[model samples]
Target: MKRGVLLVAHGTRVPAGVLAATCFAEGVANRLKAQNPLWENVLCRLAFLEISTPDIYAVATQMYQQEGIRELYILPLLLLSAGHALADLPRIIDDIQRDCPHLRVRMSSPLNDHERLVKIYQQHIHDALQQESGIDALLFVNRGSSYPHSYRIFQQIVQQTSASFPDLKKTSAFFAGLGAGLSRAFHRLEKSGVRECLVLPHLLFPGRLSAQLDRQLKEWAMGHAHLHFRSAPLLGESDELMDVYAKQIVLFSLRRAVQTV
Candidate 1:
């Protein structure tokens, strides 16, 4: 069966977000080229859940009718395996499967890849801290979710990353939900005598949220002369991330082939 891949991300309204998602999809495709026997001829495409062009439903239909794809595999680019990953995406996949009953479809999640992401984040922090030192506190900020399990997992990952920096006093805050937000995190850190702080925004790519965070950081810095913040850049199309992602695609293909047999 001819197979194709879909990389689905939570869509962004900003132009930079659109470009990042598109470029990352292309990068994933290039990295997988001839890397696996089963995936050698496979094609990868990108789609978004909402607020972006070329939604998942449209892309899947095009792949089936235009590109003659018989088997499809979906890889969600969402970091947290919350409502969207668990509830919303499955419904979309079900709709696609129903519309094309003959098409074989499988989906995968990146929820278990926290360790890999943390390694990347650590490297980013190390690079950012090269010019400055005495950054004794880390405020890891996440997108946050309403789901309990997802929220717990986010905290767990924060703790896991914190373990690596024994010297830095670490705390986490969420961008949404009931958890402590950005302002609260900053105030907490400031009161705790964290003079030099590293504000790590654990975002995958650039978007409105990233821009908002930048503005907020600037606003906070202007008011607080006592505290200094060095922000680590958001995740991008890194070679290391793409290499593991390509292997993930290959591994999924192998497993699917065996199951069909």
Candidate 2:
């Protein structure tokens, strides 16, 4: 049976965000093709959940009808196990399966709390702060979620990252819902006499939210000249990130093959 790999991400209004997702998917596809002959014939496509074209349902239908792919493996590019991963994605997949009962659809786990991902975060933070000195605190920001599991994963990442860099005080905040929002978190850091801070956004792509955070941090920094604040770039194309994607695809494909056999 012909196999297809569908890489899905939370879409964004920003063009760069969509491009980042597409580039990452392409990198993974290229790596898969290079690593194994079996994947050479595999059809890989990128889709989004919202705010982008070629949504999941439409892509799946096209693959089934036009490409005639018998099996598909969905690799979610989300970093947390939030509403989209837990509820929205499954519902969308269910709808797709109902429409094309003959096509087999399988989903891999979200990119949450993996060791490789933690390593990526650590590398990004280290790279961002390498030029600066006297960084008292590092506030790792994420697009927060209401789900308890998402919170737990975020905490896990914070704890692990803190341990990796014991010298710098590590804290976390959310852009929305649960935990301290960005402003409150920054206030607490200032009240605690954190003179220099590295604000690291734990996001995969550059989107409107990332842009807003950048602007807010800059504006806030201006008011408090005494405090030094630096915002790092979101996680973009990187060799390590591509490795994580390749691993996910290989593992998912192996699992599906075994189950089918």
Candidate 3:
């Protein structure tokens, strides 16, 4: 059966957000085709959940009709397995399956819970910190979710990061809620006599939220004599992240094939 990969992301109402995710998905498809000649004939497409162009079902149906694709892998580009990943996405997949009963559609896990993500996070922090000196604390900021499991996992990852870099003081903060906001988190860190602070976003791509965070950081930095803060680059089209995406698709394919037989 002919197979295809659909990268699904929770797109943004902001134009730049949509463009960033779309560019990343295109890069992923190109990387896969370059590494594996077998993927050349396979259809790779991008779909969005909301606040963007080409909703999930529409894109899937179009690929099915145009490409005669039998097997479809829906890979979500979400960071954590939250409402969108767990509830919304599966409902869409089920709706698509009901409409096209003959189509073999499988929904894979989101980018959450992947160890390889740590490497990407590490690289972001490493690069951002290179330009600064006397960094006493590092704060990794993430778009917070209501899900408890996801939050717990995030905390564990933060602890792991702290352990990895023993020289710097590391902690994780949230932008949405709980405790202090991003700026307040930095204030607390600064009160503890930290010389320099760096914030790394756990988001996969730059979006409206990321832009807001950037602005807040800038405003917070004004007249802060003792402490300096910087925001790391949002996840973009990189070789490491692309490899993770490709491997995830291949692994999902194998698992689905095994389940069928």
Candidate 4:
């Protein structure tokens, strides 16, 4: 039977948010078809948590009922397994499974612990660093969470990337309500004999937080000559990212099949 893939994301109320996520889903589906011709039969759907069309259950049920998809795998378009991925998503999936008993549901890991993810961020910052020579230090910033486990991944990325540019000072900062604030991080980098700083956003699209980071970084640069700043481009539907997502999806599906037996 043909499989169905649902790309679930913590959506935004903004129209741009939906468009970006949909583009990624389309890209993944296209890439999968190219690699495996049989994958052309796979149905790819985008489901949102808050700010987009077709919530999780709606999308899952549609695939189960209308598309005749017997096996469904959820590819969460998130980086960390915080509340949304850990608690909220499982509850949602459980409720959906009750309604569609014949549906074989599985969820892939969030886009973490994957080297391609590291490479994507690495490329984003590397490009920004090349564009602006004023960037003396780099900050791999993210939409943070209270969960310590999630924040540690940022540290790992910093450690791995710091070796590449020994001359530049680097740190990890969070925009959400956790860890060191961005302003504080900027000041620290400046005080540590670092004249320039680049903020790499760990986001997928140009959402509210991404816009705010751009505005804040720009504003921060105006006052301090030693603190020049540039924001990294958000990770869009690139070939590398698609490869990572597709791998996780296939792994999750195969694992689900094993459990059923």
Candidate 3, residue 129: CA error in Å?
3.6
What TM-score would candidate 4 get against the native?
0.91
- Candidate 4 clash pair list: none
Question: Largest TM-score belongs to which candidate?
Answer: 2
Instruction: Score candidate 2 by lDDT.
Output: 0.83
**Which stretches in model 4 have alpha-carbon errors above 4 Å?**
255-261
Sorted on lDDT, best first, the list reads 2, 1, 4, 3
The lDDT, on a scale of 0 to 1, for candidate 4 is 0.78
User: How much is 208 displaced in model 4, in angstroms?
Assistant: 1.8
Backbone clash pairs for candidate 2 read none
Candidate 2 displacement at residue 105 in angstroms? 0.4
- The residue pairs that clash in candidate 3, if any, are none
TM-score of each: 0.93, 0.94, 0.91, 0.91
Worst 10 residues of 3 by lDDT: 252-261
**Candidate 4 lDDT by residue in tens digits, 1-261:** 668888897888767878888888888778777777667678888899776778999999988998899888787889777888888888888888899988888777688545677777778767876788777888877899988888887677777767777878888778875788888887788779887677777788667887778887888778776666766667764678877777667666656532231
Model 1 accuracy (lDDT, Cα): 0.81
Q: What are the per-residue Cα lDDT tens digits for candidate 3 across 1-261?
A: 988899998888878778888888988888778877878778899999988889999999887887888788888887777888878987888888877777888887876435777777777667766777666788888888878887877877777766667888876778774434676687787778887887777787767788888887777777676777776677665568877787777777776632221
- Candidate 2 vs candidate 3: the lDDT winner is 2
Worst lDDT run of 10 residues, candidate 2, spans 252-261
Candidate 1, residues 1-261: lDDT per residue as tens digits?
Answer: 888998898899899989988887788788888576656778789999999989999999889988999998888887777888778888888888888877888887763567887787788768766867778888888888888888887787788877888998888878897588989998898889888888788777888788888888789989998888888877665666776677777776677632220
